[model samples]
Target: VCSPEYWVRHVREAVRFADGVRALEAQGVSRFVEVGPDGVLTAMARECLTAEEPSAPVLVPVLRKDRPETRVLTTALAELHVHGVPVDWERLFAGRDARRVELPTYAFQRERYWLEALTSFASDVTAVGLIPPTHPLLGAAVELPDADGFLFT
Candidate 1:
């Protein structure tokens, strides 16, 4: 989808999730802790809850501080503790835990030579104003098309 439609869908989904959180609050859930890579979800939850209920749950995001990758999880747990969210890290990381996993990575390979050639052709065509007047790509100096599909009488 285009940029405007993509953004509109994103906003709608966010609002729907927010509404779900509000429904949970209506059912008397007074505390929420969002655990994820970023705090975006927590922020949205906060906004949704505030809009629905003046006095609602305490929102907490586990990872808010900057730290090395190795220490980030531990730091997040500590921060959650300081914010009064109890966590059982030892149990969560008990024995036989897989320390690492492998996955394939791909590199982007495009023919820049062909891309440059196409760009040059397009620029030359635009400079000459040879494109049809009714085409959306035509810029400010577009000549209006006649009823018979010609540019002028």
Candidate 2:
């Protein structure tokens, strides 16, 4: 996914949603639980399942954007429990003396998006196309421009 050559293909993910759902079906995955801070993917996942068939499996999200964090988690856990998935509450709460203590409700942080512009010398030069000068042909057929940064082609 880090490769720039395949970057353009990531645009098709939304279009290939049904194919992904079918692949999951082949793997016998009925329940789709997305463990994230929101339900965006869960909604799209449900849409893909419904497109293939009328029936749908248990789709749950661990947290919701609008709702309270604790309430959303509790509801999601309940949904999973009802779907015959065993939840080890004792094991989950083991060892640590974790207790709910009131703290700050939210912390606001802004994201910065910065992009750098690329500079190309050949772009400003008018060439019959590549008469582009090589290193050996620099002084022979290609004449150097008098300007400071003008590209020779």
Among these predictions, the greatest TM-score belongs to: 2
Candidate 1 on 33-73: residue-level lDDT in tens?
A: 67776556876887777545454456655554342444445
TM-score of each: 0.36, 0.47
Residue 110 accuracy (lDDT) in model 1: 57
Candidate 1 regions off by >4 Å?
A: 1-15, 51-56, 63-72, 79-86, 89-153
| RMSD (CA, Å), each prediction | 20.7, 22.3
* Highest-scoring model, lDDT: 2
For residue 136, model 2's alpha carbon misses the true position, in angstroms, by 87
The candidate 1 region of ten consecutive residues with least summed lDDT is 144-153
